[model samples]
Target: MSLTSPAPPGGGPLRLRDFRLLLAGAAAGQAGAQIALVALPLVAVLVLDASAFQVGLLTAAETAAFLLIGLPAGAWTDRARKLPLMIRADAVRALAMASVPVAGAAGVLTMAQLYVVALVTGTATVFFDVAHQSFLPHLLRTEHLVAGNGALETVRSSAQVAGPGVGGGLVQLLGAQLAIVADAIGYALSALFLLGIRVTEERPEPVPGASLRKDVAEGLRFVAGHPLLRVIAAATGLANFFAAMLMATQTVFLVRVLGLRPAALGLVLSAAAVGGLAGALCAGALGRRFGQARVIRLSALVSAPFGLLWPLSYGGAGAVLFAVGSGAVFFGAVVYNVAQVSLRQALCPPRLLGRMNATLRFVMWGTLPLGALAGGALADALGSRAALVCCAAGLLLFPLPLLLSPLRRLRDLPATATAVTAVTAATEDPGRAGGTPGTPGTSGAPVGTEAP
Candidate 1:
C-alpha cells in the first residue's frame, strides 16, 4: 500500500521533517566514511607498517563489493524495506569500525584486520547507498531530486572537507587505532538519527517468479536497452577506472615522490573538497540555466582538460598546483554528478530504482578494483610519476562516451512519470521499430538503435 503522503508543501526538502532526519543520517554516515577513508590507510601504513602492495590491496578491497555483489544486492533491496535495511547496514558498519579500535588498543591489530574492516564496511556501504537512493524518490517528488541531491551532496562534501583534518588530528593525538573509534561513533549517531525518522515506508512487493539471476537480468536489460543510461554508465565507468588508478598510487606518490606527511595530505584533500561543495551548491542553478543534459555534457568538457595538469606537480609549492588541478577536476565532476543523478531519479520507475542504481553502480564502479590493481601494477613497473601521467591521460578520455551519444544534443530531459513510463516501454517493446532514435518524446527514449 502506498503511503497517503501529500506532495511536500515547499520546494526544498528542509520543509519536511522526515527528509531532514534522512539528510542528517546521511551527513553523519558520510563524515564517518571520509574519516575512515583517511584513517584506515594511516593505520595500515603508520601503525602496522604495511607495504605499497598492501595499501593497493586494501584499496582494492574497499571497492570490491561493487564487483562481488553489486547486481543481486539491488534485487534484494527492491524486495526489502529500504529504511530498515539502511539502518541495519549502518549498525553493521559501526560494529566493524569499533572492532578495529578494540583490536588496536589490545595491540593485536594487523594489516589483515585493516583489510577485513575495509571489506566489511564496504559491503555494508554498497547496500546502504543503493537503499538510500531508492528511498529518496519515496521521500521527495521527482522535481525536488536536484534540490534534494544538491543539499545532500553539500553535506557529503562538507564531511569530506572536515573529515580528513579531523581524522588526521585524531591519528596524531591518539594512535590510529583510537582515532578510528570516531568513525564507529559516527555510524552509531547515524543509526540514532535514522531511528528518529517518523515516515512509514510501504514494504516492497516481491516480483512474481523472481529468481536472483532473472531479476539481475531485468536490471541489466533496463540499462543496456537504453542509449543515455548505457552511455552514462560507460562514462562513469571510465572515470572510476582512472580514478581508481589514481587512488592506488596517489598515497604512495604523495609520501615518497612529493615527500609530504599525512597531515599535509589531509589539508590538500580538504582543499579539493571545497570545490566539490561549491559545485553542489551551483548544480541546481546551472541545471535550470544550461539545461540538465547540457550541464552534464559541458561538465565533462570543462573538467577533463584540467586532469592533464595533475602529472606536472614537482614538490613543495607544486602541491598547491596539484590541489588546484584536483579541485577543478572535482568541481566539474560534482556538477556533472548532481545533474546526472537527479535526471536518473526522475527517469527511473519506482519499482526499478534499486535495480537501476545497482546496475549502474555495478557497471560504473565495478571498474575500480580492476583499475586499482592495474594502477598498482603500473606503479611497480613504471614508477609513480609515470603511472600518474598515464592515469591523468586516461582521465582525459572519460568524457568520450557521453560526447558521442544523443545526450550531447539534448537541451532538457523528461522527468515525469508518463515520460519515464514511455521510455521504459520503448526499451521493453520490440515492435517499436527502433523507437524514434532515443530522443525525448521520440518514442520516449533518450537514445536507442537505428531502425533498418
Candidate 2:
C-alpha cells in the first residue's frame, strides 16, 4: 500500500509523511517496552532476590497505571496538542527506563526500584497511547484510517514475536540492566522521530465562559450514550478478559504439565506472534474482500474454539501442538482486532477521539486483572489444564454481545458510519443539557464543536 494513498471511499487521504514517522517511532518504542516486560521481573528475582508476591505486585502496578490514568489521560489528550504530549510521554519513558541500568551499575537494584520503573513507564505509555491514536486523524484523512491502523497492527505483531527472544538474549549477554539500555534508546529515538513530523489540526476556540470539567464530562457522556460504542466495548472486554486468563495459565501448564522447556515455550509463543502478524497483514484485504463486519464475526467465531486445542495437547510434543494452536488463535485475534479498531476509529469524531479511545481501552483492559486472578485461583484449585479449558470455553462464547447486536447484520464499514456519526454528534457538546441524538427533532451540533 502506498503510504500516501488518496482518501478512501468515505474519508480523507493518508498522511504519508507524518504517519510513517509515527509508525516507526511507535514500532521501535513498543519493541523496547515488550522486551523489558519480560526482563524486568527476572531482574528483580535474579538480581534482587525479590519474592513471587513482589513480582506480582510489579505487574499489578503496571496494570493499575492503565486503570488509573487511561480515561483522564484521554481527556487530557483531547484537550492538548497530541504530538507534544506524545513526545513528552516518550521522553519520560526513556528517562524512567534508563534508571534501571543506572541502578544496576551501582549494584543497588531493588524490587522497589523495579516496581517504580514499571509504574512510571506504564503511566507514560498510557498518555502516549491516548495521544497517538487521537493524533492519527489529524495526520491522515478518514478513508485511510483502516490501512493506517493495519500498518500499526503489523508493527505490533512484529514486536510481539521478536521482542521476547531479543530481550532474553540481551539479558543473558549484557545483563538485565544493560539490556534495558536498548529500551531507553528506543524511547529517545521514537521521540526524535516524532519531532520531525508536522501536522496541524483545527482547534476549538474557547468560549469566554467555557469550563474544562464540562469539556471532560462531554467526553464521558459521549462514551456512556453511544450504542455501537457500547457494543464494541462489551465485545472487546469479554475477549480480553478470557484471553488474559489463558495467558496467565499457559506458562505453568507448559512447564509443569506439558514438560516443555522455557526455550520451547518461547518458540511456541513466537510462532503465535508471527501468525498474529500474518493475520494483521490480511485485515485490510479481508475487509475489502469479505466486508469488514463479516470478516470480524467469522474470525471471532473461530478463534476461541481453536484456542482450546492448546490445553488439550498436554503430553510430549504438546508444546509444538500448543504452539501451532496458539498461532491460529493469534491469527484470528488479529483479524478481529484490526477490523474492530478500524470500525471504531472510522465512527468516532476526531475531537472526542482521545477520551473515546481511553474509555474503550480502560474498559477492555480492566478485565485483565480479574482474568489473571481467576486464572491463578482456578489453576491452584482445578489444575492448569482445566483453567485453560475454561478460558477456551469462554472465548468461544464471548462474542455474543456483538453477534446479537446490529453488528452481526451489518456488512461494510460505510453502513455503520451513520450510527457512528449520530453517536459522536450527540456527545459533541455535552453541556447541551437536553435529550440525545436520534431523539425527535434533535440535531447534533456541528462536528469539532466540542473542546478537544
Candidate 3:
C-alpha cells in the first residue's frame, strides 16, 4: 500500500498486488479497445454502409478530443488523483459502449450515433490514458519503469493477438453493435481491477494562482525546451500522424481493395500482432544490451523499410505483404515505445508528469484528426494503394528527428534528468532557460531539476 517503498528484490514490481491489479485493468481495457477498433468500423462500414470518407470522419472524431480537451485535461489531471480519474473515465466509456447495443436493439442506431459514441469514448480514453501514465510512477520505482512498461506492453500485445479474432467472431455471430457489448463489459471489468488496487498517493501541493493557461504553458515549455523531449515530440508527432492515416484507411483498404471479409481481416490483424508480442518480450533486453537510445533508433531503421511492401500488395498472396508490413511496423513501434516512455518517466519530475505526458499526447496525437481527414481525402481522390504508400513513407520519416538530434550523439541516456542540461533554440536566444512563447513568470524548475 506504501508506494514509496521498493519492490521486493528479484521479483520486481510485478510481485506487488496493486501493480498486478493495475496491470490487469490495463490489459482488460486494451483488449476492449482493440475489439472496438475492429467492431466500430465494421458497424459503420458493414451495417450502416458508410463510405471511405465517412469512415475517415469517424476516425477523426475518435481522436479529435486530443486536440479539443487535451490541454485542459492535463492541467486538471495535475491537480487530481490519477487512479480515481482513470476509473471514472473507464466507467464513462463502458456506459457509452453499452449504449450501442441498446440503440441497435431499439433500431435507432445510426452513423451519427456512432460518431457521438466515438467522440465520447475517445474523450474518456484521453483522460484515462493520461492518468494511467501519471499513475505508474506512483506504482513502481524508476528502475522498474522499463520492465513494468514492457510487461504492460506484453499484456497489450497479448490482447491484440486475441482481441481482433474474438471481435471478428462476435461480429459474425452477434452482430457488430452487440459485439460492442463485450467491450462495455471489459471496461467495467477494468474498473473492478482498478478498485482492488490499494496504493495511496500524496497529492502534489497546489500552485498558488495556477491558471489553466499558465499550467498548460509550463508543460509546453518543458517539452519544447528539452533537447530529448523536443525530438521525441517531433518524431512521434510524425509517426502518429501517419499512423492515424493508416488507421483511418486500413479497414476500408482491406475490405474494399483486397475484397476480404471481416473475419479474414481480423485474422490478418491477429497474425500481425505476433510481431508486437515478440517486440514486447524483447524490449527490455534490447534496451539493456544495445542501450535504450540506440535501441529506439535501430529498431525503427531495421523494420520501417518493410512497410514499403504494403503499397505493392496485390491479392490473396499480397495480403501476406500487408501482414508482413503491419507486423514489422508494430514490432519497431513497441520496441521504440518501451524504451522512450521509460526514459520520459525517468526524466520528468513527478509534479509535472501529468502535464508533461498530456503535452506530448496533444502534440503527438493532435495530428491524428487532420491526418485521418487527409487519409480519407486521399483515398477518395487517389485510391487506397497510394494512401498505403503515404503511410509507409511517413513511417520512414519519424526517425529523422532522432537521427539528426543530439540523441544520436549519445550511447545511453542518463537515468535521471538532473544530469541533463536544459537546451533550446526555439526563442531568439537559443540557450534560454524556458523558451515557451507567451508563458509568464520565472522559468519553472529548470529542465530536469524538479524532484521526482
Candidate 4:
C-alpha cells in the first residue's frame, strides 16, 4: 500500500493499514541494513583479510557517528519535520551503500573506505531513527501507543532473526559487496514507500524572533530535568553501554571461541530474534497485568543474568547452551525496550518531543563508542572469552541504578496535575509547566505517548 498518507483516523490495533505499511517499511529497511552490517564485516575479514582488531575498529568507527552527531541531530529534528528527516536519511544511506559496489569494481575498495562509508551511513541513521520515532505518536491515538511500539519491536526482532541469514546467504552467493547492493535497494525502497505517507507533525513554528540555540537548549533542559526521563536516560544509558560491549565481541566469540560456521551463526542469531519478538508481543499484556514500571524492572532483572552465558561457550555443547542463553537475554531486551518507549511517550510533552528524543539518545547512544573501544581493548588484553564474561557481568550490575531509583515504585502514571508537580519539583522550574516539556494534558492516554 502507499505509505505517504498518515494512518487512517479510525485507529484500532496495529493492523490498521498505514500502520502495517509503516511496519513493513521499517522491517524491510532494517532487514537490509542488518544484512549490510554482517556482510561488511565478512567482506573485511574474508575478502580484505582484516584481523579481529581491525573488525573492532570498524565497528567503533560506525558507532562513533552516533556519539558525535546524535545530540545535534535531535536539535535539528525538533525544528524540522520528522518524516522528511527519515526520508532524507534513507536516501542518503541508499547512495552511500550503492557506492560500495562501485568502489569494489574499480579495485579501489579499501578498509579505510569501508570505515568511512559505515560511519557516514550510521550518522545518517541516527537522524532517521530520531525522526521516525518522533513521528509515531502523531500516527495513532495515545492509548494505542504501547501496542504500536510493540508492533515496531516485533518487526525489528524479526529482522534480527532473518536479516543475518539473508546477508550471509547473499555474501556467499553474490559476494559481500554485491550483498550490500541489497541494502542500498532496501533504503531506496523504504524512502519511496515513506514518501507516500503524509504526516501532520507538531513542530514548534518558528516565532517572529527566536534563536536556534534557545530552541535547542529548551529541549535539552527538558530531558535533563524531567522525572521519568531522568530515570530512563540513566537506565538506557547503562544498558546500551553493556550491549555495545557485547556486540563488539559477539562475532569473535561465536566464530573463534565457539567455532560456529557462518550458517550456524545465522540460525543462532535468528533464535534470539524469535525470542525477542515473543517478548515484544507480550509486553502490553504484561504491562496491563502488572504495571509498566513493574514489567520494566522484571524484564531487566530477568535479562541481566542471561548475558553471562556468552562467555561460557568454548565450542562444544557450550554453543547450544550459549545460544539459548543469548535468546533469553535478547527477549528481555525487547520487552524492556518496548516498555521504555511507551513510558517516555506517555510522559513527554508534545512540543519537546524531538528534543527529548535527541537528549535521551545522545546520552544513551554515547556509550556505544566507549563500549566498542573497551570491548576491543578487553578482548585484545584478556581474550574474547574474558571480554564476553566481563560484559555479561557488567549487565548484571547495570540495572541496580534503575531498580534503586523511584522508577521502581512508579505505577500508573499520575495525571497532568501530579505529573506537572513532579516535573516542577524535579527541575525546580515552574515556567516549564505550561510549555512543551510539561505534563501532557490528557489522562488515561497511552503510557508512552511522548516516547519516540
Q: Candidate 3, residues 115-190: lDDT per residue as tens digits?
A: 9999999899899989889888777876778889999999999998889888888888888899998899889999
Q: Order the numbered candidates by TM-score, best leading.
A: 3, 1, 4, 2
Clashes of each: 2, 2, 0, 17
RMSD in order of candidates: 4.4, 6.6, 5.2, 5.2
Candidate order by lDDT, highest to lowest? 3, 1, 4, 2
Per-residue error (Å), model 2, residue 396: 2.6
* Model 3 ranges off by over 4 Å: 1-6, 415-419, 422-452
lDDT of each: 0.80, 0.71, 0.83, 0.75
Clashing pairs in 3: none
- TM-score per model over all chains: 0.91, 0.82, 0.92, 0.89
Cα lDDT for residue 391, model 1? 90
Q: How far is 288's C-alpha from truth in model 3 (Å)?
A: 1.3
lDDT by residue for model 4 (104-135), tens: 88989999998898888989988988887877
Which candidate number maximizes TM-score? Answer: 3
Model 3 scores worst on lDDT over the 10 consecutive residues at 435-444
